[model samples]
Target: MKVGLLFDARNPDGWRRPWARHYARILELCEESDLRGADGVWFTEHHLFADGYLPQPLTLAAAAAARTRRVRVGTAILQPALRLPAQLAEEAALVDLISGGRLELGLGAGYRLPEYALFGADLNRRFRQTEANIREVRRLWSDGGITPGPIQDPVPLWGGFYGPRGARLAGQLGIGLLHISRPMFEHYRQGLAEGGHAPQTARVGDLLPIILADDPEAAWPRVAPYLAHQMNSYRQAAVEGTDVPPPPLIRSDELRNRDPDGPWGMLDILTPEDAAKRIIEITQGLPVTQLIFWASVAGMPDDLVVRNIELVSEALPPLLQAAHPAHPAHGREREAGPPLAAEGGGRG
Candidate 1:
């Protein structure tokens, strides 16, 4: 399987650092991942947050592109709602050229009402806007008007949309998806078929919150707080501009419940071998071309996060790669677009 590391440079109140220092540290980690042979390095986006979530993923992607030579760089879910399609296309093109054709664009129709309000994007029409913007982006890429075309013939695209309608739209647009729901994935395939693309063309990639460590029981306490912070930030953003009362922050203790089939928020601290087995079982029949896990989740310490990236680069790939021999992805790994996944599968 293709392996990659993702960072959002989150600096929550308790863990806050100088923003410049944080970005530098994050780039250092991305460099570390690339040196360790990670398939890709990715960034996520957000805005108007107290914790200072990453607001400009393309800016960071460009930075990462400059920092790493071997690793693909990407935006996990850059909202196209905030920028004009031509602007988005041009920026992506520049990053693609900078990375030598290693940019994977994952777009989302944004759910945070506060961000939509700040960008003057209509929340109710965000999906349609995303679709329209994508069409315009394609036009810009193909037409002679765009000054510097992207290095890749067609830059790989993926959707961060999770629901059925959005998933179908993503498929119709011939973009890959970031999802884990099998049922929703079926909708994506149906959309692809409806769009005159083969159903076998459906692909997905997900950013798992899981941590890999030598000792699961021992590592749980150390990573749980950071995981909780990551989860709560997403939850808090969901209620940012809505009438619904924000839920209390997730406690580290609540991350317990290791039952394989239980209703646990289920973030496991696993050894490399166990992490491989879990990934294989979890994605047994899915078209998973990219598999990503958080790098330095919620400002996790460099030493600890570095070890995780090392295991990801060195330990996880062979284990997952071996498993893929028995359960292949029907040659989706050979396709040229979306250079994020490895020869087997790429990362987010």
Candidate 2:
């Protein structure tokens, strides 16, 4: 029942020149707002998307670790197959030390043909490569003697999956699972049980787009366009043979049997209340340990973003408490300490 925030670092306006300052402000706000209220902060990695800016999560997370003392830091997902596993292990350990052992590593095989093409990585072998990368990274962290071992013994490694194969792999590897939605959660649970790893206590977190408003109706116009844009982007990725499937939230009949064109043809009509209700219902059915909300998608105004966080904070507590009455509060004794120095250097 822990709550966290996820940001994609998207640049919907196609502007990159101001990315440094924009991201700095983003980190600052997250430190001041999200870190104080939530248990963790998460980011994602994407490339060449005129709509998004971040291509590196380790660097960004290292900054976050330095700025915040209490909140855990993580990557909602980094494409493990595209980079050297050893390098990732080193970076993850450094970030963990900087955060005083509050790093949640979520690794993924990666989708997006454009990213694969840009990196010259074979998309088809991504799953195998991800598995290999996870094995190597774990080895490096647990046994390989990198100077200054991780602050926490066996830093938690969460497998990011959008499908059954990756979910099964996570259970088999004895790592936590990161699910994107409710259906994904159900799929992962079945996958884990089938993998002969039933009753595993490994961590699981859900990623959902969340926005809260005084009146759900008044909030729709402000958030819907951005939601549509993201949906369309995923649809494009799916059409290009990336493993991402069309979002199940959108009904099949609405697309009129035609391929889901970006969000324009499919997403504009859905209301925020409907979206929130859908997500709530989905999470309730699944065995989710934590729920992470992507509150700031492209084109979502900063004011609305803050309001959404407030709404979610007020609304979700009851559900979370009911599901996990023993969930820990944010300002625990372990989390109270002076800010630590940024490991590997750079402003947090």
Candidate 3:
């Protein structure tokens, strides 16, 4: 059960200041804490939101790679339709080189009508565009010859699928799948088998919101509103045919009525222990090879975020160690990545 941290870096207060400083600190923490327990770090791409979310992911991945030593870095998702396939391939290769081949490329079709409208892309053709983009990217990276080609061939690509077609495409293309929840795992497994890739051991990651608190009661008050905000945002977005499900705010009742094929209901209430236990169950039942948690959402303060990381680190070891008893506990915590340096000096 490999763990990774996902950062949206949503500046909900609006971009009153440059994000470079904040991002530097974030990367520094990622390197340090990732060494402590996390297996990887991930970031997302969005354009022109009131929250000042990052629009570029490969750039961010490169920055993160430079800061960290052992932890793998990747985009939680790259909106493929926004990029030319060849350009995306080139950037991916460069980042992979920068990270010494420690890149897990997660590609997705563009969502958000605002972004598509801004980019002049037809939203209806998203799946088609993604398919084309994926095909072209593979060709450029694996088959196309450059005058000066990349140091490595065929970087690992994970297809981010929200539905059945995308899952089938991933298996057909022999790429890993990135799903949002556990039920989607069944779809991937079925898709892989149907695609003539039976018994596949391909990688899959589940994305979820996570926080670890000293006390659930104390943490709940602080974290709940932020979690609710996230849920509301998703609910609003889902109405636009985005497939962003509402968070599971009312657990017991929601759990009883849970749609096996739908996204997870709001998870803002689960304690760290319950969250970890749920995660283990989901991973064990699903074909998930990696688990990525959205660690810094709702504008969480840096100190609280670090404490959350520590909590997760503490909680995960015994579980993972017990699960893999044959392996020795090589949990030697490493120092966090270097502090965000000046423009030229820092990993970014």
Candidate 4:
């Protein structure tokens, strides 16, 4: 599986940086990820967020493409239902062109009702609208609706939808899936057959919301606050404008072992060895093409974040694909010990 980085460009209050400076850092990190052997650089989208969450992922995507020589630059998800099909197609094509055919266009039916309202889009019809937009985008790229078309004949398209229903739609539409859980993977394959598409047409990836450190227990204190900010922000936005009670804001220490199956899922911290094992379990016996980890958590500082990227890009991949080495009673591999998930940060 390709090692990828996910950047949301979220700068929470109390940890904020100037917007231009923050963006520049992202491009620099994208360059670093590429030079350091990372395979893809992915960004996420959000709108009207208090932390100034990235609203235009494509803009950064183009910049990242230009900066990196080899990494594929893409969106973990761009909300298609909120944009005019033609305009979105044009922008995505430009990004692809800048990347020299290295764009993975992931589209999702976003859950943020406020984002829909901001664009005068109907939230209830988001899935159908997104499906139509996907068709329109394909036609635009292939049928000459777009000028000076994208470098790739059909830019690798993916559905960044959540849950079984969204997975099925991705299958019927015959696109790749960016799912987070094992159950969703099953649903996506099922949808592929239901839509008369070959199951082999399936390409899947997971947004593994994890942190890798040499010593996870030691890193928890430094990592928890930023992680908490990231999760709590998502939690609040999810229930915005709804009668449903918002989940309680997560605390830093509590994140050490919260419910993985709970609403605000666990933010796991793992050693490279343990992380590889967790990823294997997450994607084992599945067609997982990519595995992505967040580049930073709510604008986490580079000192703490960059090392993880280096480990993910370099140290981790080898362990994942290699045969198990015989370990001494006390060894680097032994440092990983039992799975971190047993503490509630992984698949339950």
Candidate 5:
């Protein structure tokens, strides 16, 4: 029941700050999360997003690594198709070393057509590219001529998935899986077993949007705009053939007494008590290794996001773990394959 915080720094037009300041604030928030009982801090990548999404996650990851001491630093999903495998490997290794072996590499085949076009990459080949990139990156770290590879013997690698294809690919590669829902989590585990690997050989983490407050009714006004913006943005992308599916529309009339089990990808808005109760219920029959709370989203104000993080951190983990103990992901420490054992020295 490790709890991490994800920063989806979407600076929409009306709720925007200067680009430089916006990033600085995100990093500051990451630092705060580290001090306030978070196990990890993660960043996400996107390109050509209308709301000025953070396109360069690795750079921000390095900055976060430098600023934080205890919390692990990670990329929720770094699009492998956008960069050369060797380059991506180098950057990831450096960040791992810089963070004192605290980096979890999360890779993805990006969905947006515009991003692929802008990067001169073929969207149709992205799935293949993602698989290729992971192989090449591992090879470079293990056998390439680079001096000093990652500090972690084989850095923990996780794949982000939009569907079963990605889940199956993750299983085939023997990497961890990042899924948005419980059904996807099951798919990933089944895929792993189908690949002839033990289900416990890989881990699964869930990325969820959560809003925690003493009075959720009073808090909805402040959170709805950001939540709505996030949902609508994904809806638009889905319409354009992005792999992301549109979430059920978030409506004001549907705010109160919302069923926790109603939809697969809707936001979770609850008081601390309800959050603990709902989370316990959600993980009752699930083996979710990590619960990565998406506290900062679509230009929500810093204070509110920080408060939400605190509330979630305080409320969820112990309760859920108490309800469902002995998650296998917490016990597994096997690396997918042996490192190439390259000869290089780097500070980690």
Candidate 6:
């Protein structure tokens, strides 16, 4: 299995840093992940959050691409409704080029109504717009008239689907799937089969929020604040009907007071051994090609986040070996990518 890092960069009150430093820290951590043999570095997109969540993920992807030599840089879920198709295509293509084609484009029909209104897009028609934008992007890439297209023949597309319709759309387009639900994954595979595509060709990534430390007893308290913030933020979105089948609230009181049995299906704070075992089980028998870890969640402190990255890196090789024995050992390690500019590139 390919191991990667995902940064949402959500800066909650009392834990926030300067925006420039936050971005810089993310890249610095990306460099650390690459050095420690991570396969990719993924960024999430949000807008107008109280904590100043990342709003421009493709731009962030470009920044990540510039800083590291090997780690694949990607946007976890860039809303297609927010940009003109051609303009989005141009920006993505440039990032892919700068990264030497190491870009995984994950597109989403954005959930937040406020975000849709802010961008002057119709929330109800966002999915349709997403579909149309993707088609236009494909056409642009195929057209010979367009200069400086993405270096990857088709630039790997990973559709972020939360429901059956989106699953079918992903299948019809033959792109990879991200943050997949089990039902959606089945639907997507079925759709692919109906479309005359090989089922094994489907790439699925599982997003798991994890933190590692020597003493779980000691670490959970430190990481719990950010975890609570992360969960509560999602809960609020779900309550607002942005995400359906609402996520369980990881209560702040429980975390702050170190309540045992805090929450399941959310943050998995474990020791290296436990984490490795759980990852193996969580990913086993699934189409999970990539295991994306949300390490620096809710803007956790730089030191704690770095330690989490180090622990995961140390455990990943063995975890990959046990979970995906068919592949060569080197598959667990990071692969070298494009040349890095002296000044590095894309930090907006």
> Each candidate's lDDT (Cα)?
0.81, 0.67, 0.67, 0.81, 0.76, 0.76
lDDT of 2 by residue, 1-348 (tens): 567777777767632326666687678656754433667788888877657647899888998999988777889888988888778888888999999999988889887777888878988899998989889888887786465668887787788886878887877777778874554555566656766766556567767645555665566665665665666666665556445555555332333343555321332222334544555565554556667777566646666666555445444545445444565322342222233222222211
Deviation in Å, model 2, residue 296 alpha carbon: 0.5
Report the lDDT tens digits of candidate 3 across residue range 24-104.
767776776566667778888877665667788888888888887777788878888887888888888887888888888
**1-348 in candidate 1: lDDT tens per residue?**
577888887888876777887788788778777777788899888999788888999999999999998788988889998889989999999999999999999899888899988888899999989999998998999994587999997899989988999889988999898876688898899889888888778888888757787777876777778778878888988998899999998788886745667532446677889988888887878888888887777876555676787777777877887777764422233212222222112111
Clashing pairs in 3: 31-337, 32-336, 32-337, 247-265, 247-266, 248-265, 248-266
Lowest lDDT sum, 10 consecutive residues, model 6, at: 339-348
Which ranges of candidate 6 are over 4 A from the true structure?
239-250, 255-264, 328-348
Query: Alpha carbon lDDT of residue 242, candidate 5?
Result: 58
Candidate 5, 1-348: lDDT as tens digits: 677888868889867777887787778777767766667888898877789777888898999999998778989989998999878988998999999999999999988888888889999999999999899998888885465689997899999986988988888888888874566776777778777888768677768656776777776777777777777777676556455665667664454455667664557677767776766766665555677878676877655676677765555555665565665222323222221121122101
* Prediction 3 global C-alpha lDDT: 0.67
Global lDDT of model 1: 0.81
Ranked candidates, highest TM-score first:
1, 4, 6, 5, 3, 2
Error of 2 at 54 (Å): 1.8
Question: Model 4, poorest ten-residue lDDT window?
Answer: 339-348
How does candidate 4 score on lDDT?
A: 0.81
In model 5, which runs have C-alpha deviations exceeding 4 angstroms?
180-186, 194-196, 240-262, 325-348
Evaluated against the true structure, the overall lDDT of model 2 is 0.67
lDDT of 4 by residue, 40-157 (tens): 8998899999999999999989999999887789898999999999999999999998889999988999998889999999999998999999999999988989787899986898
